[model samples]
Target: MQNRSLRADDWAAEALRKYSDMVYRLAYAQVRNRTDADDIFQEVFIRLVKSSPEFESDEHMKAWLIRVTVNCSKTMWLSSWKKRMVFWEDKDLNRIPAEEAPAGNEALEEALDSLPVKMRRVIHLFYYEEMSVDEIAEALSEKPSTIRSQLTRARKLLRKKLIGEEAKRRVQG
Candidate 1:
């Protein structure tokens, strides 16, 4: 498969064209910052270009990219662990503002960011990417049961947080 002679440049360009947003969104879901998301975005493609293993299918390609993006994001997070306090203080969304952000978007994003990395990744893939449970399990290299469990847990946590915030707001009012 490695001998199939895929040009790195061509592959890189195609990947960026077809999946750049997907890659960036995945990274953003992890690190929650533009600069680090961009870094992880670049690193995902770099690893794809330089790595020796050949992908078995487009699904394989997608899984590889997602896995690499997750790892690169984790690396950036660990390296910048000290910078996290600054992250909290900044209170900015990593994504470009959409034309219309639905109500509760910020609160939901905040809840998502508050989740553990594993749960965050699973929830992101399940909802943001609109991936099925099987697809998310493949991308995450986890069992379908694990993905389902993580999604359920994330839902419960987010519901609790949002409800708590609403109660606090009412109390203050």
Candidate 2:
């Protein structure tokens, strides 16, 4: 809804107020740290304001935001990961961490943060959002087949990595 897009004066304030938690959480989920997530969140909104994207629908806006978050997360990690050696530096900065998270949630988040950027974004969008591959494709500006293929590959990778970790834990136990 173009009407929902922010006016010149209201753009930054409105976007930050409405989507800050969501964008921060999504970025943190990908990066798994406070500093990186905050950086990604800021970058995502900055890109939104600068680009002035005329979102086609709510879904379109969400997709674009997620896409930008994913990219910012990747850039943060790729360039500054070495500088950010501290563990979970941004824990206090998060606004949302799902108070009653499910079992093995931390492990899942650990595994998720280890995934490559593209695969992680797709998995997050699909599983967290309960979005279909076609819907994900529409959101990401990707083809349905590509989303399906990426999901398949991401699943296989997660299974392999998680299972291997489990097996290693059992062996150590």
Candidate 3:
């Protein structure tokens, strides 16, 4: 019994260390606020601890965590108190290595902010997380075709928004 308990504890620690950043990033992507993302992060892990469900594999566990994070994000977003609040910060994207960031990173971020939440989530999972459409679909419990369409629409919206931003800048200058 003691050995089984220790093994479970070790598994939880390992899982946390392996997936915390991914969980946090997914949360941040959904909510677009540091504080809300942190809250979602804590809530996701708390749910994980409370449920203690057995996973068939690592991929299954990851998908489970992502689904929970997305659900929690939606709940938080829909909360009455959250609707009345405005919290904005760009720190999460700043974690991208300078060399990896595009020359117009700020413009890209602004464009992303303008996208609908579903589009933003799909885009972030595809581009930032380097997930394929099928993987994103699995994680989000969405269809691959749906994920593909969302990615296509997101790219078009981003291009339109970025171009508008550039046009505005040129007019100002």
Q: Against the unseen true structure, what C-alpha lDDT does each candidate score?
A: 0.79, 0.75, 0.83
Q: Clashing residue pairs, candidate 1? A: none
**Candidates 2 and 3, the one with greater TM-score:** 3
TM-score of each: 0.79, 0.68, 0.82
lDDT of 2 by residue, 10-107 (tens): 75576677778878877866776676677788889889978989977766677788778877776787787453565566444443356856666665
> Between candidates 1 and 3, which one is better according to lDDT?
3
RMSD per candidate (Å) reads 4.0, 5.3, 4.1
How are the candidates ranked when ordered by lDDT, highest leading?
A: 3, 1, 2
Candidate 1 per-residue lDDT, tens place, 34-55, comes to 8788898888887877884587
How many steric clashes does model 3 contain? Answer: 0
- Residue 7 in model 1: lDDT: 63
lDDT of 1: 0.79
**What lDDT tens digits, residue by residue, belong to model 3 across residues 1-173?**
35333254477777888999999988878777677888899999889878998999998898899889989988988876744454456445434555766876888767878899899888878887798999999888889999999999999999999999999999999
lDDT of 2 at 158: 89
> Of 1 and 2, which scores higher on lDDT?
1
- Candidate 1 Cα misplacement greater than 4 A, ranges: 1-9, 80-104, 171-173
Q: Between 1 and 3, whose TM-score is larger?
A: 3
**Winning model by TM-score:** 3
